[model samples]
Target: MSSIGTGYDLGLFFSPDGRLFQAEYAYKAVENGSTCIGIKCQDGVILALEKIVISKLLKPRANPRIGSVGRHIGIATTGFIPDGKHIVKRARDEANSWRDNYGSAVPGPVMADRLGNYVQLFTCYSSVRPFGVMSFVAAYDDLGPHLYMIEPNGVYWGYNGISAGKGRQIARNELEKLDFSTLKMKDAVKEAARIIYATHDEEHNKEHEIEMTWVGEETNGIHTAVPDDLLQEAEAYARRTVEGGEDEDVPMNE
Candidate 1:
């Protein structure tokens, strides 16, 4: 008989080898979700996601994977969308509470820590299961651009560039070659689009759309969706880079 079922029945129980099967399962859910990316550059932070379009009748941009939490903070999530939405709501609440108590917007690290604690609680109790989602939080604060990734296990970390979900490995490789200290927001947007386009699996994910948002100096530190004109331009550039076999020479400065 397999020992898989011996201790995997409950999230609160630990297997003989000390593995938390429930949390691992939650991570699998995230791995199966659409790809989401976050990058912190000199001028600002960018959040992007490849949204899998399930139906032709569905309205465009109806189910966005990226959302703004506060004036300067944005979140991109991948996994069970409902679970992701729950986290988004909690983040928004935390931001509002912080502003009410401190008379200023909540910082990125503080928000990530609070959310990490909240998510970690579910893994410790038997009554509730872990949240099936991984999220990236991006913000532009007084200290400059910040990017953080929160996992289903409640662990979180600050990153210059990070990617989650199906195409994470490919996206990570692409991000590793960039010079973040000099990377501008415009180039970051194009890079984001290129990464998403490169990672999309046509056989598995037939139809998809790119969702990108940013908080930067140009926007006066306000979080907002990438404008339609710029978004279209980035999409065009990304298509050329991916389809033209110019992956090795992606334009970083231009």
Candidate 2:
């Protein structure tokens, strides 16, 4: 018989049932489930998450997966990707239905609120049980980027910026230096990668995966940056200030 532990509040979501949580769970493997950061820039909101992916049942790695659940809103995730995909699929389908009926994309903030509600429901019934998952949902609306933590029980809170997976402490340390309110989309993406790269272990041979989506007044649509381009930009930004290749502090003046 499989012994599932009691419900734990490690953050991603609360589990009503107790079960044996893995090391990743002990560390609250749920990325943004613990802390999130958000910056409302002049152009729009920039939301970022730690690049680590961890769980008791999963291996350690960097998985940057983000998407637009609605036409105008985007979500950046830092947790069990399968669950994130599950949530995204449902959200996207619902958004599409709304668009078909309304003839326009649903607003970003509204999409986030709806998604958050769904997460809450998921947590209530699923978090503490086996095969539970945690997630970070970063969204944008008229205001800017809004960050949140979604548990298996279906509860989530809107936050600014957050880190998940492994080495988030290192990521958070880097995030502390930024003035989020003035950040622009371009600079925000660069900084997001810079922080993650800084915290990642170079000894490990793994694909440096990252995905960024921008939505706001200028480009209120979702656009995925090429990994190579993003790396080049991130390196250049770091070179400006640091003695190394780039400074990583290039401000978005726009």
Candidate 3:
């Protein structure tokens, strides 16, 4: 018998096999999304997203995949972008609430935890569907730079490096080979660009753009878009590495 109309129809119910089918579907949605990568460097954190261009006529920069929370935190998302934006709005609200109540910027871990709880709420009620998105939150706080990934199921975890979407497995394998202890932030940026390029499926024949952001000493601990010159340089390097078959080479500091 097909279980399509049974427990899978609602996020509030679980199937006999101890699975939340709705949540699993939400995860599948994320897996099919555009790729996003997060790397925690010695001095800071990096967030990168592959923005698929649906139409050439679409205004450039009309929709950004990355957003800021307060002054110090930045978030990047994969999966349904509208759902991601909703989560961004909630994150900003939470940051504002924390600052208003405590007279301080919200910490990275606290922001991630609150957002996780908020996303999880959707799965608990029959009135709402699970968010079809996964988010990466990056921040530089008193404890230092932090990187976290929040899943659709409401779980979030701190990671040295993480990837989501269609190219996650390839991106993760590349991320694992890096030694962050000695890796500089600039190198991390180049590496982020490189991994994105490496994971791209040329056969898919889709137009795409790279969007990156960081929170670190270079930005004075503020979350902001990567500078155009630097970003362009990283993209160029990525292309060269991928085409020249030089994947093992580490980026040298300029």
Q: Please tell me which predicted candidate would have the highest lDDT against the true structure.
A: 3
Per-residue lDDT tens digits for candidate 1, residues 1-254, read: 24487557565777777778999899999999989999899999999999888889989877777889988999888999999999999999999999999999999999999999999998999999999999899998899999999999999999999999999999999999899999889888999999999899978747889999999896899999988788888888898888895564555433
Angstrom error at residue 179, model 1: 0.9
C-alpha TM-score for every candidate = 0.94, 0.66, 0.95
Q: Which candidate, 2 or 3, has the higher lDDT?
A: 3
Give the clashing pairs for model 1. none
The order by descending lDDT is: 3, 1, 2
> What lDDT score is found at residue 126 in candidate 3?
81
Q: Per-residue alpha-carbon lDDT of model 3 for 1-254, expressed as tens digits?
A: 34556546665787665677889889999999998999999999999998888899988656788999999999998998899999999999999999999999999999999999999998888888999999999999989999999999999999999999999999999999999887778889899999999999999798888999999988899999988888898988898898995654755547
Error of 1 at 34 (Å): 0.4
Off by over 4 Å in 3: 1-8, 245-253
Better of 2 and 3 by TM-score: 3
lDDT of 2 by residue, 1-254 (tens): 34354445343442344542442352354643422334445565555543433444444333445666655555555455576667778678778977898987676555656766765553344343322344555445555555565555455665455565566677667767777667666777667656655655657644343445555654654433324565566645644543455434346333
Give the range where candidate 1 is weakest over 10 consecutive residues by summed lDDT: 245-254
Q: Comparing 1 and 3 by TM-score, which wins?
A: 3
lDDT of each: 0.90, 0.54, 0.91
